[model samples]
Target chain A: MDRASRGLPLLISRLDKDYAGKAGPRPVLRGIDLEVEAGAFITLIGPSGCGKSTILRLVAGLDRDYSGSIRVGEAPIRGPDLSRGMLFQEHRLFPWLTVRQNVALGAFHCGLAPAAVDALVRELLERVGLAHAADLFPSQLSGGMAQRASIARTLAGQPRLLLLDEPFSALDAFNRLALQLELERLWQRTGITMILVSHDIEEAAYLSDRIVVLEADPGRIRTVVENPLPRPRDRVSPAFNAIKARLFEALHVDTGAPFAVPTDPAPEEAIP
Target chain B: MSMEVSSGGLAPPGAAEAPRAVPSRAGTLSHPANWRRAASHVASVVAPVALPLLLLGLVASAWEAMAVALHSPLVPHLPEIGKELARIFRGGHFFGEMAVTLLRVGAGFTIAFAVAVAAGIAMGRQKTVAHFLEPAIIVGLTVPGLVWALLCVIWFGIGLTGAAVAVALSIAPALLLNILQGVRAVDAELLEVAAMLRLPLRKRLACLWLPSLMPALLGGARLGLSLAWKVVVLVELFGLSSGIGYQLNSEFGAQNVAGVIAWTLGFAAVMGVLEYGVLAQLEHHLMRWRRTAQV
Candidate 1:
């Protein structure tokens, strides 16, 4: 297949990033390669600071200072644009804004009229099934509702690419499952390309067409597994657990002391 | 660091809070929760008027007891002070004098509020500017108001210019501090959203700064107003031909204690009303949205 003949959008070639600190230069990521072509959910899973987030940031145009070039239609990435929206790990909803206002905030730089902004906010809120909580402030909302509002906020710009960075990590088990279902439904309805970064192997297996696993110690791609699991993904399904168990074993876990919060009595030297 | 009470019990923030079913307020006046809030609001207004009246009563009874003890005609009784208050309120010269003093204080206050808030916003945005302004604001805050009066008198002479300068010098430090704090206290995320949108100052001020600055700004304004008045009165006492401060001076010199008390009580009442009515109303209106913004 002549991939160029299809005009399939992707970030081609290796991505490199170096951390320049006051003390000295410390290299974080090197020789990273990824391909996210049209309308696909790409999951990048790894332990913390594996530069999985750095990759997403590079694609989103949030980080441009790097050794490699990211060619978006022959133009170098300059700054954040309306073509992409990102969801941070924390909901990051504006405390001063109601759910509706927080969602509308995404449309602020999009140059949309007030009526159109309102309509988009309403539509996204309804799609996320959080229309009932639209009037509530972010502080008044529950963990799930806040994340729903965050999703709505990201979607308000009508971006071609959605970057989700462990958005449902803060939720409980049941709520995370519901949010995953909601996200799947949203992607189905919108046909938007999403590159999600998560540490949860099951979540990646359930949601992504393919999972790209990166190993720790200045991370690099370790595995790319095509998840052939059927939709309406059930956690109790035999094949589902089989895939989950396999991914879980393959997961580096990196419980290497640093991942554990203090008060666990882990040896300090065992970390990073 | 602090405990917040929910319907069921106390809980810290950043915890999962489930909504609980609870009955309505017990009664409009009898409800322990909002009733206390309502009563406090009423008391803030009522206390200003009641305290002075009761204070005058107690002072009068003491003065009467002292008059009898000393056999001296110096200390005036409650009735004498009431008569003096009646005279001051009705007398065109005294009322006219208060109006003049108020004009000077008001002018200085408006200028101080404008400069302080603008400086605060500018400083908040630029670290370099804040670095320079920090030392100056601290100096102003620590310097005595009397020194400002003396300096202004030398610079502007003993007139409205001198009076206005005195008042501004007295309040500029405090006003600057509050305005800076308001700007500093504004949520960084909200500011980020505003910047991302490229919002204009008016929109930013209306939608962001006004709500964010209300409590601090109002608090600053109240202090500025009171401090300005004191500065104005002190200037008038030292230099002006006519004002409440002048009246107090003349009354004290003539041993008319009743007249001096009358002027002091009258000035304190005016301060109370300005605080409760003008400044507090602005605070309430500006922070109305904030009341329900977060849990």
Candidate 2:
């Protein structure tokens, strides 16, 4: 057997989750198998109640009652750890805390010196374009700005892998694009593995190197498509359109229009 | 919507002008200043005597009118009551009585607040604790101030200890209920977020649960303080020899209507001062994070 820590950032096999519903123990996820390479960007695209979030929570070590074997590097996650950070859909910033103070909590368990923590918080706020709002409380922030502050807080922990659970779902299109670009830049700069759960097909295509499409009713992966498009991929480009169309088809969305052919298209019908 | 309305109001009344034209900005400059001037004029007329002061004045006049209409010596006029109050203060009987009552209330309140918080936090966080205390808290809530006062007099035999015990027992349940509700109302999402962040138990309690439960705690403290006074007075009237309640009892027995009204007024004045000077200020300082409605 290969050692767990050899270059693989994450591995999961036969993952299953059952929720105690009013009727009975309802199955939410079943027979999931996935492997994440180090520094890879993977997006789990699924409909509501498809258990994409459940998977993210499981990997983030927030949920432990699942029947899955998940390994992060050499370690099996038993509970939330400092090395794996997760961001929820809501900003969830502590209302009593100022922006800087909220971000400061990210590295609280790291035992860094006070000066170092302050410096880290300042740097993260500056990176997220919220340095000016550092002294303001969460209630004083706009929605987009609060989300950016949340992102800064998450990143301050210096997690080796970041799990984002529909982090941009509540944002407007303009703010969404800006955040997506910011996230991509951060990912590229940090070279940290990221697994994002999202229903936005275009977002999955735009930010991720690989997209895992999940089907509902005992949510399981239906397809995993690798995007061959290069970085800074234009949303309107033929290559981007083709990849998006193929994803739509995998997710069973009928675009009702044919996509423009890519100049260098894959011969396979899909990359699964 | 308001922003759109204000911007529309700021627009120049010209069909040919662009929406973002500089001429429109110049035309709009004086509009808000004029509106501000009108608002200030109205505020200047009404702001000096706000609703609370008006209501207080109304209540005072009504109280005086009722005393005159009733034609009973017991229902003293406001001026007569005020005169008795001044006499009591001038004779130096007021401070000692006030001191005795305050000490009992302060001691009782401190004990109740401390125990209720510890017990409330336990009940809020643990099912077993809540299950054990639920029946007792319910019973306590229903029991009256007079009942606790009588029970304390019987058990401890009519002293400061008895008065303090009665006050604590009578008021603890209110604080407990408020604290428990506050703890339960804390956002579940924030708890999950704290767990994901792997905050230490101490940090979680201090930063998350405590802050979330603050409004309830402070509210309970405010109510508990007022209730403690009432219970202490009842206990003192029934048993003790030296407090404001004892003074009221003596005055009532002597049929000195002005004296009874004077002691009652003194108690009210103390409560009002404490509420305004201490509790209200504490609440404003602690809950400064809360946003108030704007006009």
Candidate 3:
């Protein structure tokens, strides 16, 4: 990273989020503080309901109900900006729109000339391998292809910060692997800052520069592990497996254990 | 219904695989695949239509048999009704009455639709609006078409205004309820996606809310149009000088069973054309996106 780009980090300081319940305001996220360096890939991985997605929501500026100071570069994120692109797990493409039209919508607020928007859409579609399916609607596209188009749509705006909330968790294993590789290539090509929320530890290990493991029950960041793997990571490599194992450990998974049902002790016996 | 269209056994080869969109064809079916496609298309079309036509035939035959067995003046045979229908067609008296009734339904339904859509949006968006407006809709639902027609006759003085108002009142509540439910059911996730993408408000509303409201909109229209037809007939039967309903009432007063059956069948034919030919076509076109999703 260059000196100028190095200083500008995506920072979250003392972040907190709550949901209103019959009892009171129930806290979802508590005191989350993290910094993502510019042009870096970071993954937030945790079990369900651990506020992994909430953190992305805050950065994407969709949830202003939360208490947090989220700064991208120097400016605070008060609301969603064109430069921060978000891709949800469901793809969220408009059913009525063709793939090209859906991708073109990413530039809807850009006010670009028609020719330029079309050119950008074409280029992005080609990159995502969805150029042939341009005229097809979301309902027509396969799950993987739809997700690829969604990624193309997000990239068409040339966002500086990309937020992905389990963008490929819905896909089969093969498509998921292909998309992860494609994502890495895009990141390398654009140098856009990306923060992904995923449950798949292997996915996080494969794509991220740093993996932030989170724990549920009043969600908190358990630890952030630096990934020292080189580019175009070999998933079968010893180093990659080592990092994956460490991530599993950070998430408090019993990696060595096989499937089993625990037997309850006698009623009078003390519980471990 | 969509499932019947989508899940046919001869579902095209592409359907079993990636479900690539079938290119929309025009009149010139040049390719050989187009012929098989057309043949399969015919079979698919016939599958739905054959049963309904058969059912209609059975009902008509049963009614004819009942008329023959009873030999009653009240239940005229099919031939008597057919003869009366032919006479009415030749005289062209039915057309004028039909036109007047249709005009009233169109005007009344338009008014009801405009008001209900606006009100539904308001009710869905604001709890206070819903609280204030809900009781009126609930009470309106409970009030029958006859009562509304009678009340409207007193209020608007027994004419087009009275009939139209009655039809609108009878139909609006159901439309409003459907629309309110639709509005409330707009996907929060998609809205979040729109916001996160920084899509302009116009684009968001166009691509998200409008499309999301389609099922509700169509549901309301189908209900409203059918209800408007019924209410208008009741209103006209009670007091109007001219309409299909008035003609039916006159026929009933004179004990002309064949004339009543002819008018009823003729009116139903027009409604069938309007519903199956026009509204059904519109629904098919608008909901083409749903075809593959069902599969």
Best TM-score among the predictions, by candidate number: 2
* Residue-level lDDT tens digits of model 2 in B156-227: 996778888898999999999999899889998899888877899999988898899889988998889879
lDDT of 3 by residue, A1-272 (tens): 44235323699989999988899988899999999988899999988989989888888888788776889988998798878888999989888889999999888778899999999999887767676788988887888888888988887776888899999999987677767777776677667888999989989999999999888868899998888677767676656766887787787778774633122212222212
Q: Which clashing pairs does model 3 show?
A: none
lDDT of 1 by residue, B1-295 (tens): 0112222111112233332224564557666777787888999999978997898779767878887788656766667878998998884766687788888898888888888989999998899999999999989988888888778878887788888878887899899998898898888756644553445677678768876787788889878887887778778778887777778888889898889988988888877777778777876765443535224
- Ranked candidates, highest TM-score first: 2, 3, 1
Please, what are the lDDT tens digits per residue for candidate 3 over residues B17-123? 35365666866687787898899999998978898899889999999999989999889988889999998778678898899999999889999998998898889
Measure candidate 1: CA RMSD: 9.2
DockQ of each model vs. true complex: 0.16, 0.28, 0.28
Candidate 1 C-alpha lDDT tens digits along A1-272: 23222222457467668888888876677777777776787799988878888887777776678877676545667776666677877887766667898788778778899999999898877766677677877666777777777877877766767778888898987677766766776666556777899988878978988888887556678877667665756665656655665565567443434333232212323322
Residue A90, model 3: Cα distance from true site in angstroms:
1.4
Measured by TM-score, how close is model 2 to the native structure?
A: 0.88
What is the CA-based DockQ of model 1? 0.16
How high is the TM-score of chain A in each model? 0.85, 0.92, 0.91
lDDT score at residue B178, model 1, on the 0-100 scale: 87
